[model samples]
Target: MKQLKFNIDSKIKQLFQYEETKNIFDTYLPGMRSRLESQKGVSSFSLRKVISYSGGAISESAIEKIDQALQNVIVYVDDTEITEYTKQQPLTTASAEMKAEGMYTSIRPGKVWRDTEGKRIQTHGGALYYEDGIYYWYGENKDRTDGNCTVWTWGIRVYRSKDLYNWEDLGLMIEPILDNPNSGLYPEKHVDRPHILKCEKTGKYVCWIKQSGEEACFLILEAECFTGPYQIVKENYRPFDWEVGDFDLIKTEDKKAYLFMDVNHNGIYGFELSDDYQKAEKEISRQYENLHPPFCREAVALFERNKKKYMLTSGMTGYIPNKSDAAYSDSWTEPFQSIGNPHPEDESHSSFNSQISQVFQVPGKKDLYIAIADRWVPDYPIDKRRADLIMRSVASHYEPEKYPMTEEEKREIMDRPMLEDVNTSKADYVWLPLRFEDEKVYIDWSDEWRIEDYE
Candidate 1:
């Protein structure tokens, strides 16, 4: 490649043409302009592209610094600029009464979700339960204070919805037991991934939560009502003598409930829940021991389709998003065959820069499932964390051909009324439609969609 000679000052001037781009450079490199202006030589540099350059002949140290600066510049465009621009277009809002009357509502992933009272939805890592014609969502009540902590100090939150779009907060269904130090719900312990199962024999509501602390285990609680002041029925419920991580409760068609958990950070293990869901009866790890790579899975979401059981699990990478894997089998106790990633080719592998929380069947709709995921934002200040910016990196890489949305489709999304809350943190839900072709499953990305679209 032919080299071009230009002073550092000239290059800086060229970058200043775009205001958004200039702002990013300034934010990432405070003294970049002055530092470049002070350099007095006609630098030997070759432009590979408008934004990329090569200075192979330059001093190695100087070249390294320039490379680092360029990388930082790339982060600015990749993360910050795109997210800010997309969110600038405001979403239209509808009246509460209108929404409650069965009006079609839009479901947008990574947008602020609010309840009937207009409070931001606090549920995270939750499960959906359909009972008596209402869908109840139960999840951890994440604290939204300055620290943006994930500890379940307020306990599990419950929200009810006739239609999944608009939810009515039922407050904290299981409050942290502050008075009893021996209680599993004690404030010091981090409680999360709340799964509720209604017993077929006794008609009692059973709740299971992963309690993390000195002795991490699954805590089982029960209540007579769906809206509960559930009491702790069992604590430290350890299956196969392993600490529980992210987990799920799946009730089979045969009325057998099973608890699937990340045991010892290894592959997932299945245990049969007793008739009342109060105790773990048998270890069924032998079935899926070969399905996943050892210690490679967590945050499991299990469901059945076309008479075959399927599971979606995230790699053990803390809060960062990774490619999710899937497995299936004819029987829950039989070995499942790995089907690789269930997402289409896109930025973030069509998982939408999130980890799977749950995969559930839409009420009254056959062969339709929704994959609920958490787009986890760093637990830090907005400016320092750059949660929106990080998401933008993933969003900007989305290939339109892979997930096409026409201008009319875009307008439809913007026109749909949604509740907004300024107090909410950057963490948001990334709910996508789960589609099955033959025995293989895939998740399709939609900007905004309604349940009727599937029907």
Candidate 2:
């Protein structure tokens, strides 16, 4: 973590290295920000000489004062050396002392997590399913060069782990249906919130994804093996009559599986899964139904603690992180009572600046639960205030008049080609330990953590 020394003779352009040095120039050369258009030529000159070119705008005394201040400034930088904020680099997985090979010692949230092959892991918005002694991680694969757009579905990316930290890339278990344009897996379709359930009765694995495209519904797929050419069990199937966004699937203690989903932008509901785990059995209960667009929810994540069912839902802000709501019920099929935002002081502002994806209990730990969230579009400019985001797709659905839009206007919003693409390859994942103090779930911001830390 060595920082570069602030060299006085270095070009003025290099002053963008850190805030301390940059502030020195900003304070001394008041008009320096106005000359940003000519930064390239200005960068060619040393800081000591830039004063001469400033045409009386900057004085020699100001430069010397800047020099005095920069002498104590060390430029914190990244390997990329790009003019951006400092990024956390993943810890080396090569430590032989690790109990599991390729095991990462800490869960570095909001950091670049490289896989065994020294490539970024693409798993996101997916749950950890534990079977036998191994845990399988499944999520959308954003590693595709298909323009780095999330709307295109590559497949359900899969990885396996003996320890939660060390993961082996298993590639795409469910390949995209590239041949059919009407297929939910088409390049234009946005597949999100993938969840896998293992049915012991049938001895098969069920993979379902919330796909929004030609058909806005859950695309159900099943496979005989975990790593598979998962064939479609159902296509364009809407468990309810609405445009669904994100969902979560959980198999309960009674050998029954329940589906918790965002019923369009209206409310959050729970449905029972059929015996084969291929389709939704029936609508069991709906909560947050009374909430209008202002308080509407999406990205439903369900889990059980001490036989009490808990649910987490994020506000309906597309790609932008929002405050997450926590609720609990006596049964998975029952309506949950709102527990409000469960994040602690630092994270209470905006769910640790990450949206809830899923909350899962660590293997072999009865009470230890982990709240997995995605810092989606991490660098996208937005805040916790939902009132400020009128251009968001969900906002149009909730209130068409205040944010009026024609049919074509609505379709053209998220179109990558029609608009400037916000490539999501740089998106980050936020994994925090969820502490249940009595009935409340709290997530404190942790820059880096390990599962063993809980044990």
Candidate 3:
């Protein structure tokens, strides 16, 4: 056997750091080679190595070490040795081929959550429960190999995180129950928008999910654990007969619980949940016209700021971006004023480029709540759809006598942090500051932001 000497150039060294380049080495080239070998049905296959370019013009000693690395992979066949550099070129080429076919989109653009390694978080129209000292995140496991977001075909997945960044998969919280009669026509009956709460008096964990349909139903189910082996509790369990929109629950200081939703599909609506949350009391409907958008609003979050009440609603765009509109009032009911889209310029704000999957009011942080979103990447590889969860802080700074938002403020709000350009690639999480005025929290997206020290 003859030894082959092969060298590498600096250009190839840098390309190795890129996933797109390495994915070529890892996934595509091997798949192609495997398929080709199987079709041949042969024990060994050899191809002619016709070199088009070869240069030993080493300008640096570092290049020489790189060359030695390449030489180790060189092969000699029929007295013709293939360079190590040449062998790597095929893998690089294969990666390009697979990427051009959209194989790495799913794995790329991972979510940003401040200080957390977030590969397992997918809060898709899901819910969060603040339990004990930890926050439990539960949502649809769209991180599977299905690659489809149909009304059916997915189940709830759960994870627990202490600081809302690093997550440990607790397995599927809600499994697909095909045999259940109320589970709709197919096992794939979509389970969207999950919100969890702990009953103040009973200390029970409750989750509310929005079922799929033209006229949607919001089902409030209770479980013993935040990541539930959830069982459907009757009574207030079914709101199928009513047209319910994005619904969220808020507990008053008095230990009374209230459920809020988009009423008439135009504005905020509220109803008191029974002590057991089995059902909302009949004739308990209250509407607020001015607090939310009259055109289109979904994904609602209820927050209290400076002793005032505010309701946040996001526009409906379904995996596409859209503007977010909010409103607030002293009372949960009427006289609510609409605070127009907070991030009109954010390409991902509308529809959140996904949707307001869940709003987690930090059980640990005082006067702090985090709005959770899923950044949908429909073009991901491996039949898996990926979503990025974003957190923004809402604050209140307003004089009730004055309008909730001024014209100048509205213009400035959307202009900053261009969503298309906002760097989420390396950002673990983002904190958008909001002000509380008159009782409601107003969220304004900020690129340059800082949190004040409480101590």
lDDT of each: 0.64, 0.70, 0.48
lDDT tens digits by residue: candidate 2, 343-395? 74752356766787889888788578888787766655344343244234445
Winner of 1 and 3 under TM-score: 1
Candidate 2 positional error at 286, Å = 0.9
Q: Which stretches of model 2 miss by more than 4 angstroms?
A: 1-103, 145-151, 381-420
State residue 307's C-alpha deviation in candidate 1, in Å: 0.4
TM-score of 1: 0.66
> Quick one: best TM-score, which candidate?
2
Which stretches of model 3 miss by more than 4 angstroms?
A: 1-118, 145-153, 180-187, 235-240, 263-266, 282-294, 333-335, 344-354, 363-367, 377-433, 437-440, 444-455
Span of 10 residues, lowest total lDDT, candidate 3: 45-54
lDDT of 2: 0.70
Clashing pairs in 2: none
Give per-residue CA lDDT, model 1, range 1-455, as digits (tens).
Answer: 22222322334433544464456456554655354434322111122221232214445565455445544443223433222222322222334422433332988877667778665677887778888899988787654321212223457889999988989888889987655656777654667688888898989989888986447798988899988989888888777678887788889777899888877665677788889878888887543343232226778899998789998987653445656788888877765677978875535442566778899898779767989887664222222123233333223234335344444543333221111111123467888888878899998777898887887
RMSD of each: 14.7, 15.9, 20.1
lDDT of 1: 0.64
Ranking by lDDT: 2, 1, 3
